[model samples]
Target: MEWSVTDLAERDLYKLLVNTVLPRPIALVTTVNAQGHANAAPFSFFNVFSHAPPLVVLGIEGRDLGDAPLKDTMRNIRATGSFVVNLVDRALVDAMQVCAIDFPGDVDEIAAAGLETAPGRKVAAPRLAASPVQLECRETVSLSLGTRHRNLVVGEIQYIHIRDGAVDERLHVDIDKLDLVGRLHGADWYVTMRDRFQAPRQTLDTWRAQQGALRAKPEGEAP
Candidate 1:
C-alpha cells in the first residue's frame, strides 16, 4: 500500500503517478525545426499554469531510446522559440498516437501521421487542422530540471485558434461542442468530456439558507 519513490524504479513511480492522476489533458504539440521540418508529439504532462498573461507548462522528458540529448519537440522549440499546442479530440486520437512514436529526427510527423496542418497566423509552427483548439505560443522559459529526466517548458500564448461555433465573440467556449478528449493511464487510453455535469460550489450564505430551511422543516418531513 505504501511505496517509497526513491526505492521504487522510475518506471514503477511513473506508472503509479500517472494512474493516480486519473485523467490529464493531452497537448498535441507542434514545432518547426531550423531546417523547416515539422515535428508533432502528444504530451499528457501538460496544463495551463496562468491566465492573465496566458501561460502553459509542458513537462518533457529525455529521449527514451537514449539516442538523443533532447526531444525533437523540445529541440525545435529551442531552435525556433515558438510552438503550437493543439488539443487532442476524439476525432484525432489515432493520428495523435501515431505522432507519439519514436521516429527519426528528420521525419515529418505531420505528414507521417497523415494529419492536416493549417498555417498559423502569428507563429511559424503550423496548427493541427483537426484539433478543436490550437494555441500558438512563444517560449518564455525552458528550465532544466534534475539534469536528465525532466525539463519544464513555459510558454506565453501568442494567439489562440478555436474551431467555428466552439467559441463566441466574448471568448466563451462551449465545452459540449468541443468534444475534447484527455489522456488516461496506460497505453492508448483516453477519456471523453461528453459525459459531464456541473456542480457549483455553494456560498456561505447559500449554505446558511439551506441549513435554515432544513431546521424549519418538520421532523418527519422529507428534504
Candidate 2:
C-alpha cells in the first residue's frame, strides 16, 4: 500500500494528500488588482502559521491551460502585496463556493457572490463583512516551486476584525459565536465546528498522582 512520491502521478498524489488530510481550515481570501478591482477566492491550503509576527500561508496553484498561468488571487497578491484572509463560517459557505468558481479576471467574484466588504484598515484589499474573523495581511515573501506554477505565500497580519460579541474584554473568544467551518475530504465536502471536545494537558504532578492511586489499589480486590 506504499508508493514512492516520485513514482506517483501528479493527480494521484494530489488526491491522496487531499483525501487523507482531514478537516483543513478554509481561507476565503480577498485581494485587489493593480487597477483596484476586487477579487475573492477560497483556498483550503491555508493556515495561520505563526503568532509572534502573526503570519499566514496560502498554497496557490496555477491553471494548466490558460493565457495567464497564475490564478487571479496569486496575481493580485503579487501586484498589490496585500490580501485579506476571511475565516469562513456556516453562513458564508455558499458565498465561499461561489468565489471558488473559475470566473474571468474581469469578473468580480465578490459581487457575483453577493457578499459585502468593509475597507481594510492597513491593506488595500477589502474584508468580507459576513466573515466571523478577517485578517488583513501584507505579503512577507513568496516561493515559486517547479513548473506547475505553485506558490507558497507567507503574509504578515497587520490588522484583524472579529465579529462583535464573539470576543470579550479579556480577549476570551466564544467558539459557538465564532461558528467557523472547515474543508473535509473530496471536492465539495465540508465540516462544521459543532462537534468538538477538549482534552486538557496533564502535568507531571497529576500524572504521578494517578500512578500512585493505581498502585494503591489491591491486585485481587476492586479497591
Candidate 3:
C-alpha cells in the first residue's frame, strides 16, 4: 500500500510520524517569563544535534492547542535568549506530565507541577531540582516551518549539571543510575532505558575476515 503526503491530512501525517519513530528522549525545558516567573514544559520533539558547538535542538509546535496561541516558553526564549533542558528520569516523569498541560499564560507550570527549581549558572532559566541531568542552553538560532509556523529552537549548551552519583571520574555517565525515560506514541505512553542491548560496529577488514573464502578473487588467478 502507498499514500501520498499531499493527499493525507496534517493530523494523519503527524500520527504516522509519531507512531513509527519508536521512543524519543524527553526534554523538560524550563524558561523564565519577562516577569521572572518560571515556566516548564515537556517536549518529545527534542534531541542533541551537534557536539562541536554543544547544540540541542527542540521542535516547538504552535502556541495554542487548536491554533497558534503563542507558547510562554517560545516567547520567553525569544525574549531572554536562554533556557534549560532537563532530562526526565523515572522520579520526575509525573511532574513532567503535569508541566505538559496546556495551562494559561499566567500560570506557572513548574510551580503547578510541584517541582523545585534552582538558578542556572549560564542562563536565567532555572533548573528542575528533581532532574538528574540538566543542560543550560543559550539560543543560537531558530527556524520556522509548517503551515502553522512551528519553531525549531537550536541552542548551544553552555553548561551541564549532573547529579553527583550519575557520572564518574572519567566523565562517563552511569546511564542506569540516571534512570531516564523516553516518550512513546500516546499521551501517557513512555519507555525506560533500563532494558537495552549492544552491537559492536564492524570495519571493512573485519568484514573481509568474517567472509574469508566467500570473497571473490581475481578471475582464474588462484583457487
Candidate 4:
C-alpha cells in the first residue's frame, strides 16, 4: 500500500507516523504553575537531542478529541520556563498511565497517580520519586508544528537524578537495572528493554581494510 502525503488526512498521517516510528521513549513530564499546582502527563513524542548542553525534545499536542484535555503542563512550562522529564520504568508503568487521565487543569495528577514527588533543585516542577531517572530542564525554546499547533519544547538539562543502582562507577547505565519501558502504537501498547542486542561500531581502519578487500574482489563477481 502506498500513501500520498498530500492526500492523506492529518489523522491518517498521524496514525502512520506513530505506528511506523517503532518504539518511542516516553516522557512523563511534570510542570507547576505559579500557584504551585502540579500537572503530570505522558508524551511519547519525545527524545534526547544533544549532549553538549544536554537537550531533550517533547512534542506536546494540544487537547484535540479530549484525550487529556488539560493543557496544564504546556501552560505551566510556558508560564514558569521550566519542567521535569521523568523517565518511565516497568515498575512504575501503571502509575505513569494514571497520570494520563484527562483531569481538570486544577487537578493534581501526581497525587492522582498515587506517586510521590521530590522537589526539583533547579526547577519549580518536581520529579517523580518512582522514576528511575529524572531530568530538570529549563526551556530553551518552543517551535510550533502543523495546523494543530503541536509544540516542540526544547529544553537544556539543568539537573539529572538517577537512582543509585541504575548506573555503574564508569557511568554506564545498567539496562536491566533501568528496566525502562517505551511507548508503542495504540492506546496501551508498550515495549520493554529486557530484550536487547549489541553491535559494536567498527573502527575506521577496520572499515577501510574491509572495503579494500571488497574492492580487490574480481569485478565480474557480485559487483
Candidate 5:
C-alpha cells in the first residue's frame, strides 16, 4: 500500500494522482490556428488560479504522432495568444467527450463533435454555444514542464460569457442554474452540481459565542 513515487512510472503516477483528485472541473477549451481553423478539446487538469487578474491554467500534453507537433489547443494559443475556456455541463457532456478525441490537426473538432460555436467578444477563438460559461483569455505564459509530455499554459481572462440566468452583474453565479459538470475518476464519468450546500465562514466573535454557549451547558450534559 505504501508505494514510492520515484519507483512509479510517469503514466502510473498520473493515474494515481488524477484518480484521487476527485471531481475535477472540465475545461472545454477552444482555440484557432494561424490559418483560422478551430480546435476544441477537453482538459480535466484546468482551474482558476487567481481572481484579481482573472487567471486560469490548462495542462496540455504533447501529440502522439511523430510529426504532429504540439497539441492543436496549445499550437493555436501560441499562434494567436488567445483562447476560450468553456465550462462543461451535464447536458453537453457527450459532446465534450467527442471533442476530446485525438483528431488530426486539419480536422475541426468542434464540427466533428457536432457542437455549435459562437464568436467570442474579446477573443478570436469561438466559444461553445452549449457551454454555460465561457472565458475568453489571452496567454500570459506557456511554460514547458517536462521534456516532451507536459506543458502548463497560463492565461489572463479578458472576457467572460455566462448564460443570462446563470450569473448577474454582482458576480453571483447561480449554482443550480449553471448546472456545471465535473469530471470523475474513470473514463467517461461525470457529475452534476444539482445538490449543494453552503457553509459560512466563522469569525472570531462567532467562535467566542459558540464557545460561551458550549460552556453554559450543564457540566455532565452531552455537547
Candidate 6:
C-alpha cells in the first residue's frame, strides 16, 4: 500500500501529502513590492518553527509550472526582506480566499478582498487589520529547492499583534476567542477549533504507577 517518492509524479505526491496532513494552519501573508504597492496572499504551507528566536517557515511555489516568474509574495519578500504573517481565523476565511486568486501583478489583492490594513510596527509591510494575530517577520534565509521553483523561506518574527480580549494579563490566550480555522483535506475543505479534546502529558512516575495498578488487578478485569 506504499510507493517510493521517486516513483510518484509531482502532482500525485503533492495530493497525497496535502490530503493526509490534516488541519494545517493558514497564513494570510502580506508584503509590499519595491514600489510600496501592497499584496496579500494565502499560504497553507506555513508554520511557526521556533519561539526562542521567534521564527516562521513558508513554502512558496513559483508562478505557473516551470521556471516562470516568482509569485508576488515571494518576489516582494526577496525585494524588501520583510513581510507579515496574518493568521487566518474563521472570520477572515472568506477574505483569505479572495487573496488566493491568481490576479495580475498590478492588482491589489488586499483591496480586492475588501480588507483593510494598518501600518506594521516593525516592518514595512502593512498588517491585515481584521486578522486576529499578525506577526511582523524579517527574512532570515531562503533556500531554493528542486527545478520546479520551490522555495523554503525562514523568517524571524520582529513583532506580534494579538487581538484585544484574546490574551489576558498573564499572556494566556483564549482559544475560543481566537476561533482560528485550519486547512483540511481536499481543495475546498477547512476545519475549526471547536471540536477538540484534552489529553494531559504523563510523567514517568505516573506511568509506572498506572502500570503497577494494572498488574495488581485481577485477570481480565479493568483496573
Instruction: Estimate the Cα RMSD of every predicted model relative to the unseen true structure.
Output: 2.0, 1.8, 4.0, 2.9, 1.8, 1.1
lDDT to native, each model: 0.89, 0.93, 0.88, 0.88, 0.89, 0.93
1-223 per-residue lDDT for model 4 (tens digits): 9978999987898899999897999999999898888888888889999999899999988767556443777878889999999999998899888898887666677888899999999999999988989999999999877656478899999999999898989999887877889989977799997777898799999999989989999968884
Instruction: List candidate 3 segments past 4 Å from native.
Output: 64-68, 213-223
Q: Each candidate's TM vs. the true structure?
A: 0.91, 0.94, 0.91, 0.90, 0.92, 0.97
| Candidate 1 residue-wise lDDT, 1-223, digit = tens | 9987789987898889998897899999999989888889998899999998899999999876575678888988989999999998888888998899888666677898999999878888999998999999999999989857578999999998888998888989898877889888887678998777899899999999999999999999998
lDDT of 3 by residue, 1-223 (tens): 5799998988888988887797999899999977788899988899999899899999988854666455777888998999999999999988887898888776777888999999999899999988999999999998987767589999999999998888989999998888999888865789998788898899999888767855566567665
Per residue, candidate 2 scores C-alpha lDDT tens digits across 153-219 of 9999999899999999999999899899999988889999898789888999998998899899989
lDDT of 3 at 50: 89
**How many clashes does each candidate structure show, in the order listed?**
0, 0, 2, 0, 0, 0
* Best-performing candidate as measured by TM-score: 6
Judge candidate 1 at residue 131 and give its lDDT: 93
lDDT of 5: 0.89
Error of 2 at 61 (Å): 0.8
Q: Name the lDDT of candidate 2.
A: 0.93
In candidate 4 the C-alpha lDDT for residue 176 amounts to: 82
Model 2 — which ten-residue stretch has the worst lDDT? Answer: 214-223
On residues 63-107, what C-alpha lDDT tens digit does candidate 5 reach at each position?
776876588888889899999999988888888878988775566
Q: Which residue runs does candidate 5 get wrong by more than 4 Å? A: none
Residue-level lDDT of model 6, residues 106-148, one tens digit each, is 6788999999999999999999999999999999999999886
Clashing pairs in 4: none
Worst 10 residues of 1 by lDDT: 62-71
Instruction: Enumerate residue pairs that collide in model 1.
Output: none
